[model samples]
Target chain A: MNSIVPDSSFTARSIAENVQSGEWSAVEVLEGYLSQITQHESEINAFNTVLEEEARATARETDKDIAAGKTLGPLAGVPVALKDNLCTNGIRTTAGSRILENWKPPYDATVVQRLSAAGATVIGKTNMDEFAMGSSTENSAFGPTRNPHDLSCVPGGSSGGSAAAVAAGFAPISIGSDTGGSIRQPASLCGVVGVKPTYGSVSRFGLLAFASSLDQIGPFANTVRDAAIVHEVIGGHDPKDSTSISEPFPSFLDDLERGVEGLKVGIISELMGGIDGISPEVIQKTREAASVLSENGALIEEVSIPASLYCLSAYYLIAPAEASSNLSRYDGVRYGLRVSGETLAEMNINTRTEGFGDEVKRRIMLGTYALSAGYFDAYYGKALKVRRLLAENFDEVYSKYDVLLSPTSPCTAFKLGERTADPMTMYVNDVCTIPSNLVGHPAISVPFGSGNDGMPIGVQVLAPPMQEALMYRVASTLESAEK
Target chain B: MTEPISEKEVSHVAHLARLRLSHEELQLFTKQLGAVLEHAKDVEALQLDGVEPMSHPLPMENVTRKDEVHKMLDRDEILDQAPVTEDGRFQVPQILGEQP
Candidate 1:
């Protein structure tokens, strides 16, 4: 097995293979990742919290299991990072809000529980947009996560921390939640593979809610196969989460090696044209990728979904409306930070005033207004209707096409502060990806090309809901062609 | 129909969300909110006469689990972590009013 190193060659499977075979110990893997975090933490700000001591302790137990002739689980001895939004037992799960800076959960999230049960060591928690709002990770109260490819640019967000962790080699894989474009956007910017599993495919019991209906926990890794490995560990049903699917998880590992030969592929015609702010180079690369699929015995056709143009508009309305209601639980009386005053109203005011970052406060306000009694019929209601139309449109396309493809973002990662003041511009960055979230389908971002600036560009593949196997096969084919 | 946000409305929403905005933040968010909400105008333009509002795409019923006691952090272990706590419970300034 290739020794784990701080480069593209090192991945989760590579590290796990080496660790299990006794060529490397779990401690060596932990120390290697910790050292990388120490070296690159300043450049990427990938981690919100790094508990080296606990990780080493867990690693020791893992090595003991290996030595004691215990049957090792898949991903046994692999070190992974959890997104800050995930509830980690005894770890500060801030969700990037100052309000929850010191609030540790009493229990682990289902995904965290599953990861640990599979024998993966949780190294640390990665940064995220505060409460998973905002397109760029800059909305993090802690500070922005810089891009690993170029230190001055963003790593894409609200999963920027996870993407940067994988890109900078702080960890081979990290788990992130995608409410909108959180997983795929950051993965695109950081040049990694990120999958937002089909909604209802993963349990959301311990995830900090942004838009509950749209949120799904997925994996970020340097390879599609490694993502498949991690997703398999954490993807399943839990009685605690009703929305989790009762349907069986497809054998992603088997599907990944399954060739994409003769697969019917649809390229959204509207995604190629009509969108502004797209780079010509990105369009060219997507076309090249489509051509590669065509040459590989796959059928590629141009399909149109007219409702896609309204995705951003509908998303902004629905996400905020849900966020407004979901976030109301934090009233300075529950878990986390509270600023008290002489009266209850004043206490709520002072607490929220100081606790939430500006972007979070912005969304909360926007959501509150949208869900307010009178406006609900027009704003939230209308958006839900449009969401249904988009879902229907996707069903129509998937009836003809096995999978849909587009550029993950209009361009490569932009400079960190470029669109902070322009929320519209930032929202547009999610144009190609948000439609999937609205439709509650599955999508993955696979790196396609290096732009003129040497930053990575990603092409997205969207699949009908619960059809992750089709996506893995297509993405695996593309990943092979790139190699 | 455009329900353009007024300065008064922005302040009201801020009060509801418990945010004490500076005059600068107020001015900035007012313009920003207007533009953001203006984009919401397109949402009203969508047609859905017979469509049922979907809260989640997945078809799910009550997800309630049995009330069996699972392993949980002991009160001492949990309250030991509270930034502010009293005898056995998490202590906060009287939310409804001040403590005696």
Candidate 2:
């Protein structure tokens, strides 16, 4: 019999403690979340596939380990969902694209392996954009995920489903990959704590490559500490990913209580300025967040990032160029979808044409054109220099300030199909988040307050490479201020 | 703004990208991609001849590991996902032929 009654405070931390102390079994914890998913999933549609029996079996094994006197890991019984892009051995993993609707991996992603070692239960694979391409989950081939806050609104993509899963209470934590604003944008739209650890800080061995240089897998949770716990579990160097940082990762959860006292926080001036599409409510909320941090013993000042305004242009070129090269593997023969034709080349062409969605095709065409011989210097090459400018600007600021601040998204959750017809408008949603990706910095989104529309707004905290501990400290400060 | 990409260029890029587009898709994408490129023209307008291009976020290069054999996935299991297979290998359509 369970001794402790689960309440509003029953988070990942509570669930792990209760299971470790034998107050609740791992199976019971899994069952509670499974029930929540079943009750709420139809309207929200966060997950592409829910591993009901698979999660149950894993939970039972954990219970058996406890009975056999094995010690519990940090997230002993916590249920964690995965973005569909992360590969799972023997499980059908689609990157929310029709091409790989039935594809299964031969091995687990490094993060998935690490989570298992840390005693977390695998719950489900959530939905996302086709090849993690768009800013809204509407780009998904299967279907779009409605924001949990308002069933009519979108959960920002391409990691929309992962963000929605955590927001909906279907899982205490979920994993999402950030390429540009994929993780943080959706987290803000969904009113949850989401983190994008420093580039190469977390291994990307089995993450389906979108923009390889920009991609980093991180966690989404209800609290900063929960995100920190999962971040520590999944992060570190892996030989499988050659670009992963080999340095030792610091303990983020241990550093959470350090607070923002005496910390110098710089607000990114351009993001808060009169940028188009920024709701007045979101701007007000970000200004309020600055004031709260100031009252809590931190110094705040506005800092200009001139190159940041150009990040969207540079990131659009860079990410699509990488994606066009990475997605070339979806040819008919080896795995996934195959459309037949007279010759191999024709078959490959037909397969991709039938398999990819409209948004993905537009990007591939744009990317190929950018990399073509005549235009290479004008587009892709120019974008790289702009990336360098963004990096230099960030490095100069990090020397003086511990962390920089910005609104996570220009506005809150957008209604479905609001910006679908216009591609440039959709691309504008990531303007604030793209600079961090360009410079290999770490950034996180913590919910600050709600808009006049009653939807949540997020204030982003960005830090230099390997400074996630300081990043989480600011995140925790904002989280506490909300209370 | 004027269209930054022409329909002829879009068709060429689509073919190069292994995607076959219909007349409607070609026209629609030409306008859409042109608008996107027009927005991206700011980068093109900047004079940055002195700055070197950054291709990746990480600064590391020439990463290599010891040439040691480790456990590999089973060949049969790997081959199981193939659309066409024969003689324990993936099979493909004739590459030299022009048509059926």
Candidate 3:
């Protein structure tokens, strides 16, 4: 039966195209997603707030636009999920934290506005680590988002819910912020295509700040072409975000069929073996992907970025230092939760102590200590220097290779409570993806094969800044070869 | 490994960050933070004499725009989200004096 609204296995491109051709009503597409959500959302815990009424209204509007013979944007009937950090006007925008649990933003984030303008109906706000801090969704103040593949295991995070939503068929496309692999890591675990575009490629105006210098908004989708489409629609210059790159965004979808013939791909050596916590199966799958590209006429080689060894160490210092500064705005006087006290300072202290989770507090303290008077030079300053050296190392490689390859995560999804007790153990998950964020380059994780545990393994393809088309060509190749 | 940071130091940093931790939290953080910091110490081993420190990934020049008035978020809506509001302004506890 060719059911128009059957269970699972839907793509954003198909939905938009079908709606445009009057083959499927926008209502039918939304209901297909809603039916999936109704059946599985409670079990997956992927969303903190499902915008059912709002999504229905938008879907109806999309149908109206099509009936009126109006030209719609690229994503006419697509359902999108947003990481809780990105604001939605008048909707609760909790970054999966206790503090902002009931907080509603008065305005939409720039990304939200752009998605709406592109005719995508935002179905829900997905759960995430409290302030997007953890590698697993365990740091979420609500509850952890479980992997759709294995209910007992984690979907990688802080963008866990965004990935899980797409994996669980709640949404075909989703938006998440990647500070240090938040998008790609979870996408790898959930067997979806996740992208972290060039640092300033997407506007960050509405994304709740985690580490402003490192945070970049990206998408998770069922295919590389869909990811490229979503990326193009949401990317480009915005007057609202001062840091947004003013350059014109290239048509990423056009490059999908361009293919990776005669392209140079480097397997990042430090991430492949030199770093700790990488599993044999993950490495094997990544190597197999490299050969697959080689078979498809791509040149493959082993290249070393020595500074990648220190990226995790340096990132902890640099990201936390920036976070400490960004998260200070959560005082009781403004939006969100506030606990009372006699004095103003005491009120501020009490508010933060009760509002934030243990992981967030740990980061705040770590950041404060690093930026404090005595330890500033030794920790934060030195970390900044290491960041530069790592960027320089990657740049040296970029001069030779069109893109770099590595595992998106160290291993497949660990059991829910496996690494929650130890922050250091969980931090190792970002070892491969952090280097790209540090260098402000674009990267994507393509689901290549399965690990020994039967969980999906994702092979990451990274390119130099503004080279997403080149990166997507390789990712598209890997995705097609998987079948 | 021995603790690189003491409980007292953790409390001090916590105070600076405006987070009041429980006695148990202080104990846990001191041990956990010490190990994380010890790992971060690897950066100190790098010979970074001439490498210029990079704070932002892109070489961003100061972005200036003509000071023009634009539509802003409604003042009432902003106030409505505040935890404490009075007369359309965010209300806070006293700044200078002790508890009245």
Query: What DockQ, on C-alphas, does every prediction get?
Result: 0.58, 0.78, 0.75
**lDDT for each residue of candidate 1 in A355-408, tens digit (9 for 90 to 100):** 988878878888888888788888888888888888888888888899999999
Runs in model 2 deviating more than 4 A are A1-9, B1-3, B97-100
- What C-alpha lDDT, on a 0 to 100 scale, does residue B39 get in candidate 3? 92
Docking class of 1: medium
lDDT of 2 at A452: 81
Number of clashing residue pairs in every model?
Answer: 0, 0, 0
The CAPRI category of model 3 is medium
Q: Residue A48, candidate 3: how far off, in angstroms? A: 0.2
lDDT head-to-head 1 vs 3, winner: 3
Ten residues in a row with the worst lDDT in model 3 chain A? A1-10
> What TM-score would each prediction reach against the true structure?
0.96, 0.97, 0.98
A-chain TM-score, model 3: 0.98
Best by DockQ: 2
Model 3, position B70, has a per-residue lDDT of: 87
